[model samples]
Each structure stands twice: as C-alpha cells, then as structure tokens.
Target chain A: MSDAKFHLYYWPGLPGRGEFVRLVLEEAGADWVDVGLLPESQGGGARAMMEALGQGAVPAYAPPVLKVGDLEIAQAPNICSYLGERFGLVPPDEAARLHARQFQLTVADVVAEAHDTHHPIAVMKTYEEQKEPAKAHAEVFRTQRIPKYLGYFERVLKANTRGGGRYLIGSDFSYPELGLFQIVEGLLYAFPNAMRRIASQVPGVMALRERIAERPRIAAYKSSKRAQPFNPKGIFRHYAELDEPNAMK
Target chain B: MSDAKFHLYYWPGLPGRGEFVRLVLEEAGADWVDVGLLPESQGGGARAMMEALGQGAVPAYAPPVLKVGDLEIAQAPNICSYLGERFGLVPPDEAARLHARQFQLTVADVVAEAHDTHHPIAVMKTYEEQKEPAKAHAEVFRTQRIPKYLGYFERVLKANTRGGGRYLIGSDFSYPELGLFQIVEGLLYAFPNAMRRIASQVPGVMALRERIAERPRIAAYKSSKRAQPFNPKGIFRHYAELDEPNAMK
Candidate 1:
C-alpha cells in the first residue's frame, strides 16, 4: 500500500460521521491524521477544518472531508469507498464493489435518519425548541426506521452466501462492515431502550457488530484515546425524552 | 455499450428516487424497461417489483432497483454510477469518478432532507398525522437547507475550472448532472416559493439544471409520455401548509 499520509478533517467532537472514516483507516492500519484532534499550533482543530474548507478551491459542503495530497474528498461513504479501493478493503470484483458501495450508501441513509431524530425540525434550532417534534420523530425512528434499516442489514448478512454471512458485501470483512459497526454502536448509544428491544430481531447484524469490535485493530482503536466517546452533541444524541420506547402509545 | 437491456423497478406512480436512475437511462439513451409500468400479464407492475425484490438472494432494502442480467442493484446513485461506468457517463479518471459519486451522494443527502420536511415525524403515519411537525420541518428546509445544498453545488460548479463551471465533475456532463437536474426539477415543483427565492443565489446550479434540460435526449424524454409528472405522493411533495416560509417566525 502507498505510504501517503491521509488527512481527515472533521469536527473535533464526538465520532459523528468521521468515525466511519476513522474505522476504515484504523481497520486497514493506514497512516492517517485526524486534523481536528490535533493542536492548533500544529495547524489543526476547528480552525484548521475551517481553513481547509475555505482554502480548497472547491469548498466542502460539510466536514468529515478526507484530504489526500492535493485532492480533498467529501462525503463519508465516498471517502470510505476511496480508502477501500486503495487498501483492498472492498471486493476485487466490480459488481461486489458496487454492492459494497450500495450498502454503505444505505448505511449513510440510516445515519442521517438517526441524526434527524434529535433535530427533526431544524438542525440549526436548539433541541429544546424542537423538543415536541423530536419526540414524534424519535418515536418513529425507534419503532419503524430502526427495524427497517437494521432488518435490511440483517437480510444482507443472511443472504450473503459468502463467509457464512459474517460480511455485508462479499465474502470478506469489507469497509462497509466497519460502517455497520459504527451504526450499531451509534444506535446503542442513542437509543439503548429501543436498541435493546430491537437487538434480538437483528441477530446477524448484532453479531457482525460484535465481530467487528472483536477484531484486533478495532479493539485496540476502541480502547485508545483516538476513539472518541459518544456525547449528546453528536448525531446520535442520547436525549432521554427522545429515547423512550413507544412514546406515542 | 453492451446490448444489455436494463429493467428498472420502482413504485409505479412517483418519480421519487427512481427519477435519478431514470434521468441517467434517458440521457444515455440506454435500452431500459420500467418494470412497474408494464402490464402484469407481461411480468410487470408492482407485483413484478415485489417478486424481483423477493427473488434476490439478498433482498433489496427498498425500490428503484435496477436489473441487468442476473444482478439486481438497489439505491439510485449506485445504479447511476454502475451505468455511468459502462456508458461513459462518468469521467474516465478514477479520482473524478470518485468525486462524481461524492456529489451524487451529497445530492442524495439533500433529497433525503427535502423528503424529511414532509414526513418529519413518521413515514408510516399519514402526512396529516404529522402535519404540524411537517410545517416546522419545511420552514427550516425552505430557509436553510435549500440554500445550503444549492450553495454547495454552486461552489462545486465554480471550482471546476475544467468545463468553465458547466458540469459538476468533469468538463463533460456526467451522471451527477443528471441527478442534479432531477433535484432542481423536484425542488421547483415542491417548493416553488422557496425555490424562486433561492434560485438567484445559486445561479450556477440553476443554469446547470437548464443545461441538462436542453440536452437533446433529456429534452425529448421530458416531452415523452415516459417522463412522469411530479405528484404530491412522491418524495418532493408540495403540501400547502408545509410550504409556508419561516412558519415558526
């Protein structure tokens, strides 16, 4: 693999979307730097992220952008796919690669929906202002969306005739499994009640999440300081009111 | 291109995410069939889509799935990217292809947010059930999300020194431009008031939309019976109450 150092620019807080990117890097054992986590004197932090965003001739729509030499890539799935290709984290076959990307995109969809549970109306507005709607949004998320998405991944795992259904795409532990790991971890953090209730329904997915965590590198990364702990400020916030099961009932 | 005929299976009525796939097929002049629109006797319609979904070893999570030979691909952008690789609708260079996928994924983000405005609380519940929340959600979408996403596209266009800002990725129109075309069309249909107000700020994006419409094949397809009209039942729905500007204010 190329020894080119990769620079990841994301908000210096909770894992958020960057965790997906970080998982891929850490799993692949790639040499990368989290710019936001570094000291300002070292040309990092929120200011560094903002500077990279503005400095790029093509400004990133948002952070969690990956900078590789002169080219800066945005979007979490896109970055993962790029790293997957370079580090052989995806399947060798084209169709399998496409499927891997498709699953990753689906994972992105679930992540966005999960984030919206807390900020249902306006992300710019305080959660306090949107509390009522967030309650409603989180209800559906915990009930319908969680099952639909996790169930889909469950089906994906069961249907894969490769690797005894341990992988999401091909017969291997691709970049997307790392993504699945993040999604499962985020859900557990955000909605422990719902996730606990829903976990049994998606044994394959839960197993895969455990499998990813058990990987030597992943296990090391999780215990390391680099693996940021989940907080309320991130996408999957643990708002007690929003995490209630069957709130409408 | 290969003499393979593509079968696209989506919900029969709504453009929804399928339109992104449809636009690519239309613009590329690919021989494809809309499985949901065909006669049931001929192995088509919603039943056909359901059968296809069930038939896949790994069942599709949702619709707008493309069937080429034996492989059934789901997710709009994934289908487009696959076709793009074969039809030369994407840049020949690897980095550019990755970037096009990036832009397409961002478009997916915008589309998802736009959809969430109308179904902020519950997808399974009726729009009326979530009407109050939808109004609040749409207000933020109109005032903030529309500009933020469109502005991002505008920045992408401006940064592309290759085509003088005519295309999103490369000097030539790519698959993402087709996706962009569909997004602009959907926004204009669903949020005419907000779009009219926001259009001036993202002239680059608007112009690109117009440019895509002006494409010979796309123009022909627009007038063709196959070009489905926008409806309230789709992702970009126009509920009168939901379209009110700054409703919270």
Candidate 2:
C-alpha cells in the first residue's frame, strides 16, 4: 500500500457526508486527518476548509473533500470510491467495482432525499420557515421513499448469492456496505418511528446493519469522540412531527 | 476499442438523465440503441425497461441504465464515467479522470436541485398539487442557486489554464464537458428568464455551452429525430412564475 497521509475537509460538528468518507478511512486503518475539526490556528475550521476548497487545482464545489498530497477529490461517493480503491476496500473485478460505486451513489440519493424532508422548500430557509411543506414532504418520504429504498437494498442483499447474502459486492465487506450501515443509522436516528415500522419488511438490510456495526473498526469509531451525533444542522435532522408514522396509514 | 453495442433504458419521450449518456455515446460515435423508444412488440416500453432493471445481477434502482453484453450499469454519472473510460472520452491521467467524475457529480447535484424547484414537497405529487411550495423553492433556486452553481463553473472554466479554458479537464474535451452542456441546456429550458438574466455573470460557461453545441456529433444529434424536447414531464420543467426574473432582484 502506498503510504500517503490524507487530509479531509468538511463541517466539524455534524457527521454529514464526511462520515461516509470517515468510515472507509477508519475501516481501512489508513492515515488521515479531519482537518476541519482542528483549531483555526492550525489551518482548520470553516474558513480554512473553504480556503482549501478553492486552493486545489481541481476545486471542490462543496465539502467532504479528500486531499492526498497534490490530488484533491470531492463529492462524498467519489471520495469513498477513490479511497475504497486505494485501500483495497473495493472489489477485485471491474464489474464489481462499478456495482459498488453504483450502490454508493444510490445511497447518496437516499441521503439527499432525507435531507430534503426537513427543508423541502429551500435549503437556506429554517425548518420553521417551511414547516408545513416539510410536513408534506416528510409524509411522502416516511411513507413511500423509506420503504422503497430499504426494500430495494433488501432485494440486492438477497440476490447476492456470490457473497452468500452477507455483503453488497463480494464475499468481503466493502465501502458500499459501510455506506449502507451509515444510511440505516441516519434513517433510524432521523425517523425512528417510521424506520422501526418499516424494518420488519427488510430483515436482510437490518441484519446487514447489525453486522456492520459489530465490525471491530466501525464499533471502535462509533464509540470514539470522532463520531459526531446527528443534529438539526446536519443532513438527517430529527423532528418529532416529521417522524410520526401515522402518515403511512 | 471494443465494438460492443450499448442498450440504454430510460423513460421514453423524455430526455431526463438519459441524455447525458446519449451525448457521450453520440460524441464517441459508438454503436448504441435507446431501447425504451423501440416498439413494445420488439421488447421495449416501460414494462420492458422495468423488467430489465430487475433482471441484471447488479440491478439498477432506477433507469438511464446502460447494458453492454453481460454488464448492466446504472446511475447516469456512473454510466457516463464507465463509458468515458471505455471509449476514450475521459482524460488519460488518473487524476484528471477523477476530476472529470467530480465535475459530473457536481452537475448531477445541480440537476437534482433543479428538479426540486418544481417538485419540492413530493416527487409523487404533481406540481399543481405542490405549486406554492414549488414557487418558494424555485425562487431560492433561481435567485441563489443558479448564480452560485453557474458562478462556480465559470471559475472552473477560468482557472483551467491547462485546457486554455476550453474544457474542465486536461487539454482534451471529455464527458464532463458534455454533462456541463446538457445542464446549461436544461436550465435554459426550465428557467429561461433567470438563466438569461444571470448569463452576463458567467460568460465562460455560456461560451463553453456554445462550443459544446457546435461539436459535430452533438450538433447532429440535437437536430436529429432522436432529440426530445424538454417539457413539463421531465426534471427541468418550465413554469412561467418560477422563471420570473423579478426574483433575482
């Protein structure tokens, strides 16, 4: 393996998309730094993160950017795929690698939808400013999207006879599996009532989630200070009204 | 180059995300077929596309899937990147390839946001049902997001001294440039007033749009019987109220 120290720039307080990149890094036991979490004096914080975004030859439009030596990459799924390939977290075959990236991109789609549940009308507006539309959007999300995505993943898990239904790609656990684990965790945190109600229909997905959480590196990271809790400021925000499962009926 | 015939599956009568892949295929002069547009008696239509999505070992969650021999790839950007690598539409350097994918993913983000401007509350609901929320969302998208994203791309164009500001990647034109062309076309179709109002701020992006359009293959495809007009059905839908330039003021 190439010995390269990696630098990650993302918002510090929230797990957000950065956590997706962090899972791969932690699982690979790779050398990396959460540059955004450091003090401003050491070239960290939001200002420094913003500067880092504009400094790269190929500048990132947003955060969750991965910088290794002179190479800078952005977009969470892209970063995860790059890191996955680098640390042997991706599959060996070309087709499987493409499938892994496809799965990660699908997970990203779900994540974006989840973020929209609380800010349906505008990203810049507060939840209070768009609470009515948020309620309407959250209802569809909780009722339709949640089950659809979970069911699709459950189907994928069951169809993966090559992995004995244990993984998304091959016999070995890969980055997309980590991504699945995170999405499930975030959904549970953001919409507990709805997710729990829908969980029975996706046993394969839930079982995989349990197995991922039990992975040694993942377990250690979750219990560590590095793991940030989901909050209103982040993508998957919890609002009691939005999580109500009565909408499903 | 491999002489594999590509089969594209997407919703017929709408360019949607499938056009991004089409631009690359057309530009490469690759042998491909839009299977969704074929007659149902010959194994085409929504039913066939839906079945195709579930039949592959690596099933796609949604369409705009590219099937080649035994390989079935989904997600527009993933398919474009794969095809780019296969047909020499991507940069030769590894770093440049990653950057092109980054730019493509960014374009996808904007496209998603643009879709939200017309369907903010629920994707299942019609725009008429959520017209008020869509109006609120579109205002922010037009006034804030349009300038932000276009301005960012303008900077990318300006900073790319390597390509002499003609492309987003290395000296050669690549798949991401095609993606940028599609997005600009989409925004103009969806929000003509806002796009025209903001045009003066992003000369490089607008100029790049012109160059991409004049590409012989792309020009031929755009004027051919295959090019589907943007309507209210697709991601970028035109609504007079949403396109009001007064929002920018």
Candidate 3:
C-alpha cells in the first residue's frame, strides 16, 4: 500500500458492519486506526467519529466510514472494496475484482438480514417489543435464507477452480474471502443450533472459514483486543429463541 | 463506450432494482438487451434468467445480473457502478467515483428498507401474512427512516458546491443522480402520503428528481414501453394503510 494512514470510523463497542472493513485492514497489514476506539481526549470515540462523519466535505450517510487523507467513503462493503483495491487484497484483473465485490455485497445482504431477525418491525425498537415478528423472521432466515446464502457460497467455492476451492476469486485470498470468513463466524455465533445442523451441507464454506481463521495475521487480530466479540447489541445477536433449529431438518 | 453490448437479467416486470441498472444503460445510450423482457422463443423470462444465473462461472446470488460478453456481475449497486465506470456515467476522479458509489449504496439501503415495509416478517410470506408487523414496520419507515434517508441525501446535495447542488459528485450527472431519481420516484409511489408530507423538507432532492426526469435520454426511457410502472408486486409497494400521513403530523 501507500504510506498514507487509513482512519476508520465505526460505532464503538461493537463489530457490526465495521468488522468487515477491519478484516480487510487487518489482513492487508495496512497502517490504520480505529478512530472510534481511541481515547476521547485524543479526538477519538463516538462523538469524534460522528463529527468527522458529519463535517467531511463529502458527508457519509453512516458510520464505518474510511478516511484516507481527505477522501471519506462510507458503506462497509464499499470501504472494504476500496481498501482491497488499494492494499492488493483484491485480484489484479478487473473481472475478478468485480466478482469479489459482488460476493462481498451478498455477504452484506446476509448481514442485513441477520440484523433484521431481532429488529423485524423497527430498528429503533427493542427485540422484546418485536419478538413476535422476530420469531417469524428468524424462522425464515434460519430455514431458508441461511441455507440459500451459504449454499450459494459453497457452490461458488466449489466452482472456483482457479482458487481450487480455497478462495472466492482467482488463486489468492481476497477481501471476499475475508468477508465470507466473518459472516460465517457471525452466523455461527448467532445461530449455533441452526448453523450446526446446516454445517454438514456446506463443508466447503466451513473449510474456507477455518482456513481464513488460521491465517497468521487474522489469528493475531482475532486474539488481539481489536477483535471485538459479537454481542446482543450488535447485528449478529444470539437469542436462544431465535437460534432454534427445529425447522432446519 | 466500447462496441460490446450489455445483457441485463432481471425479473420480467415492475422495474424493481433492475430499473436502476436500466436508468444507467438508457442514459449512457449503450447498446444493451433486457433479456427478461424477451419472449420465451427468444430465451427470455424468469426460467431462462435463472438458468443463466446458475450456469455462469461467477454465479450471482440474485438477479439484476449484468453480462458483458463472458463476464457476469450481479448486485444492483455493483452492476450500476460497473456500468457507470464503463460508460463514463461516473465522475472521472477516483474520489468522486468512490463517493458516487457510496451514495448509490445508500440508495440501495433505502430500497431494501422500502421492500421490508411491506413484507416485514418474511420475504417468502405474503404481505397479508405479515400485515401486523408490516404495519409497525411501515410506521417507523414512514415516520423516521424516510425523513432520515432523504434528509441525508438533501444534505449531500447541498454540500456539493462542486456540483452546485445539481449532481452528487463533481460537475456532471452520474449513476447516483439516476439512483436518487429512481428512489424518490419509488418512495413517492410507495408512500405517497408520507412522501408528500416530507417533500417540502427536502427541496433539493425533489428538485434533483425533476431535473433527472427532464434529462433527454431519461425522459425518453420513462415514456418508453421498457419503463415498467410501479406495482404492488415490486419492492416499492403502495399499501393504502401503510402510506397514512397521520404519523407524519
């Protein structure tokens, strides 16, 4: 990459969508700062991040905004794609890069769906208030959406003769691989019962997940304090009621 | 810009996300085919589209897949970005292009939210089946989400001294401008009461909507047979109950 330092602004205390961008930054070994995690006295934390987001010449719609010098870009998948292109985390060819982005966007779709399982009626409302719809939404998500998405990825992996099933595009690990790894991890944590039931059917996806976790930089990052654990407040929350696998069979 | 004809695969009707890609193609004046609109004898319709989706080396997770020769790319925002880059429909500068994409992705977020307002509990289930939760979902969507998203876009427009409040980035109209137009049109159709109530608050967005519609190619495309009208089956559905302005006041 260039000598430019990357500054990432995300909500403090949760991985959420920000983790997708963080994965790329971690894997690329780029010089970066999680601005939201820094001390408030040093112009950090949520307030500083919000100020940066709102005050930029090109204002971002939400957090997980990436600032490389003066340019600010938002949307987690877009930021990851930008970082991937800059850090050589994406393939060299245009077609591969486009496909990688397409895959990453699909991962984003799954992440959004996972978030909706808890907040089915309204984002601002609590899960308890929407538990009825949440249950119904989680049912479809677990039995249908999860399998469909994971199955599609498994097929993509199996079809990637170029990567020999190790990556989403070409012969090397790219941002989409990292995205898949993160989504699989998030899904497992949120829906352990359903995920376990569906695991055998998507061996390729599981294998890729393990391979990504074993990567040296990723391993280090996972163990480091930078890698925040999934929580009930985040997108991928584990509600015992939502995690039932009775419908999977 | 090249002689290569683009083939777009989306569900056969109601505009939906495909219209976002269609707007780019129409504006670019690129030679393209809406494969889903063709007759069965000509290898058209949903079945053929599904076959192409499944058979492609780089399989798309969903439709609105753009095929240029052998390269297949999916995701509406991603496809729009690809077409924008190819047809010079995006800004020339890297930062401008990135910001355009960031804006387009935000538009996509709004579209997804609009879709959920009707089918809150599940996608596979009918709106009738999820009517209770859909009411709650639509309330928040109409009251909070609509204002929040449109307000954000309005701020972006006003901040663009470079575009002079005309375009999202730099000096010329880009894919995101078209996206903003499509979204405003969709939201107005989907939530007329709420949209009408909120219109005066976002004058810039409404004005941009008018300007985009007046553009020669876009104007022609809207009047053409290819431009499908909004219907209940599409993402932006008009449910009379859901579009109530009571919540707005």
Candidate 4:
C-alpha cells in the first residue's frame, strides 16, 4: 500500500528542505525514493524538479521540490499538504485539514526564521559580513519570537484530542512529529540555550521527538548515507555567535 | 447570508495586511464589518485584533486577523480560507479546497517577497537606509521572481478544469484574486517598469484582477476611505531608488 510514485528532488549533501518530506515518507512507511542523493540519479532529480515546477512555470530556485506523478510542487508546506492528503495523514474534516496546513505553514515559517538567524542580512552574503545584524535579529527572534511560536505550538498540541499516541494526530503517525522534532532538533542545534530552557515545558512535544527518533525507519535512515549530516550549509546552521549562552533560556 | 458575525481587525491607516481579508470578504460578499475604524472604536481595534489572533497564539503577531463569535484566527491566508469556505469561494471537495489553500499560500509567499523588495535588510531601518540593498534585491525579484510567481499562478488558472471564470475559482471570486491583485497592484506601484512588461503577458491573471476589481463590494471598498492609498510605510513601499527606471524590461 505504500509503493508511492513520489520523487523528492533535493540537494544530495545537505539535510536540506527535502528532509521533511523524507522523514514523513519514512514514517508513513511509504515507498518513495530520494531523487538526488545517489550520483546516478541526479538527472532524474532535475527532471522531477523542473517538471513539478512546470515549463515556463517558475523556477523554484531552491530544492526540496516534490513530484506526485505529473504535479511538480515546490514549496515545502505545499508538498507536505499534498502528501498528507495522498497518504491519508490529514484530518477527516475540511476545517481540521485547513488547520493542519495552517500549522504546517507556521512550522515552515519558523524554519525560515531559523535560517535567517544564521543569514540575516543578505542570503547571498557570508555570515561574517552580516554578523552584527544577524546577532541583533537572532536575539530578537530567540528571546521574543521563539517562545511565542513554541508556546503556541504547545498549546495546540495540548488541544489535540488524541489520548496517548503523542502524535499531532495523537495515536496517529503524522508528520507533525517530524516537523516538531526537526524544529526542536534545529533549535537545539542552533539555539541550544533558549530551546533547552523552554523546551522542558513542552513535554509532549519533546516526548514525540524522542519517540519518532526511535522509529525504526527514521532510526535506520539516520545512520545511513542518505541522511545528510547537519552542517552550516543547511537551513538550521549552527552559528555560535548567534546562539548566545543565555539566549534560549 | 453575507451579514454574519465577522469582525475584521487591521491597522487603522494603511490597508496593509488587512486588505487581503477585506478583499476576500468583499468578493465573497460576506457580512463583515471593518472594526476599529473610528475614534470611539479605538479600543475595539485592540480587542478585535487580540481575539482574531486566536488568543494566546504566536501567529497573532499582526493585523487582518478575523473573529467570529468565539474562534479567533490570524494569518492572512487562514482568514481568507475560513471566509472562502462560508462564501462558497472554496470548493466543496477537500482536494480542491486544499488546492485553493495551496494557491493562497503561494500568493502569500509572493506578497512577503514583494515586501522584501523594499526592506531586504532590516525591518526597523528606514527605506532610505536600505535603498541600495533594496534596489539590488528588487532587480532580482522583478526580473526573476515576479515572472516566476505570475507564471505559476497563470498556469494554475489555466489548468483549472472548472474553467471559464474570471477568478481563480473559475467563474467565482476566490480570495486568491484579492491577494494576487494586491500583489499585482503593489508590484505595479512599486515597480512600474517591470509590471508594464510582465502584466502584458499575464493576460489571464490581469483579466481576473479586472474582474475582481469590478465586484461591487471591492469596487466600493476601493473607492471608499477604507482602501488605504498605497504609501511608503506599508509592506509594498514605493521607493524611487529601489525601482530604477533603467532596470525594467
């Protein structure tokens, strides 16, 4: 039932944008392939990516674009929502589904802000060139924005009616765990102090991350070459300068 | 049916973020009032804003949040989708509804990018201070991103099987138009030279904008004081330095 014809086109070296999709398919136990991680698959990578983007349609510029047969969707949340539907991970009700997507978009927004913590001024400029602004902005984000988002997500999780599964769908294996864990892990990696102090309050979310990390597929993938080691090149790059010691707390 | 219990809270000045929700409600012909518009209504502005933001929600960071009796929702697209559902602007099917949401989110991505054209470096900095960076980024966005987003949207509209409507929903006013046209209008105001050329090729989208502009609620809103005239302080600021006449196609 999981033999999916999905091709996720992302860069080979970075646990980049596409990792969210990869982690999800792994959790769903779906049959999908990483299009570019293997050298021999790079051409297919470009094809899957460009087609999903559409000819003369608009270059996605960045990777982690996904293809479900003929559709070439680019945005991460867009891909996640599509897969959620095809994989039966979305809520049964329309409003619930909208909320799921809204939550996903919020997560994506958090991730983007995390990226900017490292690259604040110009996406094209080096961290050294933008260090001052990056530091100032990261301070604002970590102290003010981070807690706001985390607290809100915690509230939403508490509102979830799922009794014990600890998933966003609680009892259901959903990508919220993957997204939340990625966020937590990224924050832990990038803004350790702030995330650590505040994270203890969101026990359910933290527990879900630990739980997902123990999932067989994710655990196996984590050990494989398929999982790109987190480095400065990815969305959640660790910059010691930005993550001050007391910033997270 | 249109006159229900919808309260919209946005900045009292510029149409800004509130315009997205305003346009959708108008296009849907929903019964909603622009809260916080008068002197005595000052406090309602504060209350209307706080609640529409899904009280205690992190995303409630800004205006244009919507409040029904009890549910307060924030984020531009979230509010639009909620209204789109009640107004029949969204499709009955979950897939189509999600698709509509995907389209709406894309519009939002572009809107943010458009905003960045003027404030690429720091949100707190004056436009003049960021003028050089803004000019450079705007060049890339105008030549590259504007075409990319417009083309993607045009293709989505063209691919619509429910075709033959002057709107994204095909024959109806979907809120995407309100958002996209806002993008178009902002880009045009901000980058006249680039739009003069790009708008020519995007006839379908242009037509849709024209159609939406003709909707009585929207037309009246645009003519009334409610439609804040585009100014330098809003998301889509018009800066001469940022838009060099020589840079356009």
TM-scores for all candidates?
A: 0.95, 0.96, 0.97, 0.80
Show the lowest summed lDDT stretch of 10 residues, model 1 chain B: B240-249
Ten consecutive residues with minimal summed lDDT in candidate 2 chain A? Answer: A1-10
Candidate 4, B43-134: lDDT as tens digits: 45545555545553223545666767655566787788778877887668654565566677777877777776776655566767767656
Off by over 4 Å in 2: A1-4, A245-249, B1-4, B245-249
Give interface RMSD for all predictions: 1.3, 0.8, 0.7, 4.8
Sort the predicted structures by DockQ, highest score first: 3, 2, 1, 4
Off by over 4 Å in 3: A1-4, A245-249, B1-4, B245-249
Per-residue lDDT over B1-249 for candidate 1, one digit per residue giving the tens place of the 0 to 100 score? 124489998988889899899988988889988888888888778888877775786578888899888788888888888887789988788777878888888888888988888888888888888888888888888888889888988988888888798878767888889888889998998988788788899999999998899999999988988888999889998876766554234
Q: Chain A only: list TM-scores of all candidates.
A: 0.95, 0.96, 0.96, 0.86
Residue-level lDDT of model 3, residues B1-249, one tens digit each, is: 124489888999888999999999999998998888889888888888888888888888889888898898999999999989888988678998899889989999999999999998789889999888888899999999999999999999888888898778877778898999999999999888888889999999999999999999999999999889999899999989888855545
Docking class of 1: medium
What's the C-alpha lDDT at position B135 in model 3?
89
Better of 1 and 4 by DockQ: 1
| C-alpha positional error of residue B155 in candidate 1 after TM-score superposition, expressed in Å | 1.5
Give Cα distance to truth, residue A14, candidate 4, Å.
2.6
- Candidate 3 TM-score, C-alpha based: 0.97
What's the lDDT for candidate 1? Answer: 0.86
